[model samples]
Target: MPVFSCADAIGGGTEPNGSEVVAVRVGQHDGYDRLVIEFNGPIPAYSVTGRSGTSFTTSPKGQTVTLGGTNGVLIVMHSIVNWTSYLGPYAFEPNFPVLREARQIENFEGYQQWALGIQGSPCLRVTTLTSPSRLVVDMAATR
Candidate 1:
């Protein structure tokens, strides 16, 4: 059995000067829903913070972005560049049991942001993976 914490999850110290977010993937698991951010280079410094509402404002632009759910999580990656390389969907409503939606908030000025809409307040577990360099976030299923 794996242990997950509701506390903020943070990792990586590398500066993604040449890296780009290649894709974003999500999956439904037995006890959690997983969100993955694929990168073309080394994974960048990132943080995951849980929030109370689904409404979030975009960085640098101040545009309001709302998602479908009672609670949400914010994902931020630093030192990232070249957002044009990511051709994947900017927003998706997976409608998973816990993870309801995933959307891109911003990709400007060496910073990247994403939001995950969740059904209820849930714990989060974040991990950095190699080989292809990816960041994984798991949200525990709400009862």
Candidate 2:
């Protein structure tokens, strides 16, 4: 099992329109995954989107984030002891390096990790990792 905390990265106040944008840290634990979102105030509803690559839709409840593309990956981390046993089998070798590095960050402790990479002329790379109850998303812009 892993431990998760949302005290460090939660920034900005709740969106005045009953929404907020939070950069969550996700991780894995005990065969499950988790996510931790930080905010200055209560966040009723929010959605997260990538700058490029694949485009997806997420409901206002912030519970589901759907993704599409050739190499798109999505992980949901919402608890402090969730593991990543739900990620179905696929070719996950090439992405190990980026995932390992993001997992080493202190803010991403005990969170589940999910990643997605679109091959060929990609504008940016989005890597999401989670522990027991946190999520860490890394977006690398290409030039």
Candidate 3:
């Protein structure tokens, strides 16, 4: 229910360089939480590694969900060039049950900000010029 949009930031054309926005959604499924990521544009070849280091390859564009630990989720967008470089590595920790409550806060305002780091080549920025993309993280309430 809670929707976080990164388009407002990059869509405004503030960053002349290419930019890629990842929108994340979190929800509860059975006993574990599920994360649904929607890629707005072309994404480079990458994988989602669990906190334990288990990695899974992802397609260039589409949506996918995986179940695992509650250490939160990390989205690593690599091989990014131009404007897309602005979108560095981003992570999210979504609250269960209240998931719908968070989506109400669009424009990424009032939401907890996660730390993002560049994987390699600090000088080289991940850049992209196209529609806004997204990465959603849904947290399940602990019973």
Give the TM-scores of the predictions, in the order they appear.
0.92, 0.24, 0.32
What digit string (tens of lDDT, one per residue) describes model 1 on residues 68-99?
Answer: 88899999999887766677788889999889
Q: Determine the C-alpha RMSD for candidate 1 after optimal superposition of all C-alphas.
A: 1.6
lDDT per residue as tens, model 3, 1-143: 43332221111222222324455454567533444544545544333322322122233322233323323223443433332323433444343432222211111211122221211111111223334454434333332
List candidate 3 segments past 4 Å from native: 1-19, 52-73, 81-93, 97-143
**Model 3, position 10: C-alpha lDDT score:** 17
Taking all chains together, the TM-score of candidate 1 against the true structure is 0.92
Clashes within 3 Å, all models in order: 0, 40, 33
| Error at 122, model 3, angstroms | 29
Ten-residue stretch with the least lDDT total in model 3: 116-125
Scored by lDDT, model 3 comes in at 0.32
- Which clashing pairs does model 1 show? none
lDDT score, residue 135, model 2?
Answer: 28
